[model samples]
Structures are given as structure tokens and as C-alpha cells.
Target: MVGVAVLAAALLLRYAALEAGVFPLDCAGAAADGIGGLCAAKWLLVQSFLHQRLGWLSFVLGLAAFATRRRGLAWAGWGSGIAGLVLYSFDPAAIGALLSLLVLARAASQRRRGEEQPGEEPRDGLGVGGLG
Candidate 1:
């Protein structure tokens, strides 16, 4: 499913950029001032930045998928997106917001579809009184 794929891609990109860390400089002495050091730092910085952007993009796409009745994808989007956001740790409260949004959206979608669970009888507005 697209939700799973987006989550997988986001996870992979996140892991790849993990090595960048807060400070990418690991070399000692003046060697770090050379071209190789600059290149290494540049590559790591760029990768990290791009990873964040891509991760956010994946989350946005997952939300869109959910809007189209992809319940599984909606759940996956919230789970992975929250996990990644927490792991990166920008704001602790964002996870809660994302979770709440997911719940609301999923519930709304289900209501709109009017789907009945297995072994559950469909409801009718008319009661036994037959007042319609």
C-alpha cells in the first residue's frame, strides 16, 4: 500500500541521515579545513536537510491518501510520522496533534462511508414503531 511505502521510504531516509547529527565535524586538527573535510561536512548537512524535507513530504502525502479512504495508510502515516518527529524531537506536542488529527479524520471517513462491521447488523432510521 502507498501508506506503507511512504512510511518505509521516510524511515530509510531518516536512517540514512542519522549519521549527520547535530555537529557533523569529526575531524581533528587543520585537516578539517581542507577540501575533503569541507566536502564531507557539506554532504552530511545536505543529506540531513533533505531528509527532513522528504520526511515531511511523506507525512503530507500519507494524510492525502487517508483523505481518499485509505484507513491503513492514515494509521501508518500518523504512526511513522509521529515516531520520526519524536525521534528528531522538534516539539514534543506535535505528536499529540498528529494523533488527534488522525483519529478525527479516520472516524469521519468511516462515518461518511457508512460501513458496517462484520457480524453487525445495519441500522435503520425507522424504529420498531414504524413511524416513518
Candidate 2:
């Protein structure tokens, strides 16, 4: 629920930025000019490229994590989200990351509750046979 909302928000922001042409500008005279328009424009270009590349990567990784129930991959998605946040703090990437983290946390909680799939042992080493 919350995760879905976050992802939806993130997607909206990402697409909006793409549609707004707010990325990739020259930095020269950006400081002297109001709003650092040139710098922002340059950074937007860089961010746009990164967004394109990392966005797809994160999506693929996140989808794989969800489909395969791999918590680590989900965490990787979270990391990617963080990177996206760093690039554009108010973007959909951040929402995507938050959603990924939420999903990972939910899966972890489910595992803690003994609801894990068959043959899928918990990684925390709580029930090992040789321990005291």
C-alpha cells in the first residue's frame, strides 16, 4: 500500500521531469544568472543520462527481487533509489527506493514470522542445529 504509493509518486516525478525538459544545461554564468539556470541545465543533462541508465537498471533489479523473492536484490534496488535521491531528491527514483525498501522490510518481517517459503531458510542463524 504505502510502497505502491511511493513508487507511483516516484514514477510521476521522474516522468514529469522528463516531460518538463528541466535537465542538461550549461553551467557557465549559472551562478551569476538567477536560479543557476545554466548550471541546473547542465546538471539536468547529466542527471538525465544517469536517470535513463540507472532508472532501467533499478527497475530490472527491483522487479527481479520482487519476482524471485531475493531480499538482497531488493536492497540493491534501495541503494539505487538512494543514488537517485542524491541525483534528484524529489524524483520518482526516491519513491521507487522507498517502495523497494518497504517490500524488503515486509519480506524480512514475514520471514521472521516463520512464513518463509519451503526450503528457504532464514539467514539470521537463529535455528542452526549445532548451536547450544
Candidate 3:
């Protein structure tokens, strides 16, 4: 799933950004600059990074829940996934995950009732539909 991949990518990027000098972790003597201003900056950066990571995680979990076609998971996933994406880009993976869950749910319910989708030709013995 595209959603899984995007979430995974976002996770990787989060860590990578943290370790890649996106923020300064060494603020030992920052107090000299003004009551630990450097320390405060570093703390903010780390906190933001963590929040971003949580968002990515939520997106991934939502996708997995969608794949399983669980109603509870579907609701949770959509709720958290969309919220998480609010601070990030509108990635196609999230959209895909949501749509897939909807489709899977529909298919599952139809299968349970032995029903077929509208406009779909019936299958033949050879595993083909409307083919001679």
C-alpha cells in the first residue's frame, strides 16, 4: 500500500531530520547565552520532531487497520491519519489507505451477502467474464 509506504517514508524522514543537524542537541553551556535559551530551542526542536513521528505512526496504523477491514480500525485510522496529515503534506498514501478501506469493507459486506457489484459481468467456468 501506498499509504504504508508513505507513512514509512515519513517515519524515516523524521529520524533522519533529527539526526541530520536539523536541531542542536548540545546546549550544555546555553545558559550563558540567556537562561538556557539554547536548551529551550533544542527542547522545542526535539518535541516537534517527536510529534511529527507520532503523526507518521498514526498514518501507518490507520492503513493497516483499513487493510483488515475492521470498522473500529477504519474509524480510528481515518480520524488519526487525517489529523496527522494536517501538519504534513497531503500524501497520496493516506488517501489510498482511506479509499482502500472503504472498498474492502464494501467488498466484504457484499461477499457476506453473496451479492455482486453493479455493472460487473458474471464470471464463467473458465474464470472469465463475458468472454467466448
Clashing pairs for model 2 are 10-92, 23-44, 24-41, 24-44, 24-45, 25-41, 25-42
- Candidate 2 lDDT tens digits, 1-132: 544555565566456554465554334554455555545655654665464555555666667776777788887777666555544533555555666777798887887886766776565446666456
Runs off by more than 4 Å, candidate 3:
1-51, 89-129
Pick by TM-score: 2 or 3, better one: 2
Where does the lowest 10-residue lDDT sum fall in candidate 2?
Answer: 22-31
Descending-TM-score candidate ranking = 2, 3, 1
Over 1-132, each residue of candidate 3 has an lDDT whose tens digit, in order, gives 645665565565456654566555566665456635546755654554354653555556556666675656665555445544543534533663465468556756777867765775546323775535
Candidate 1 Cα misplacement greater than 4 A, ranges: 1-51, 89-132
Question: lDDT by residue for model 1 over 1-132, one digit each (tens)?
Answer: 543665576565556554545335544435456646545654644554454642454356465654564655556555556545534533322443364356657677669977656785335322344347
lDDT of each: 0.51, 0.61, 0.55
Candidate achieving higher TM-score, 1 or 2: 2
TM-score of each: 0.35, 0.44, 0.38
Candidate 2: stretches off by over 4 Å: 1-51, 89-92, 116-132
Each candidate's number of clashing pairs is 0, 7, 0
Q: Give candidate 2's TM-score.
A: 0.44
Clashing pairs in 3: none
lDDT of 3: 0.55
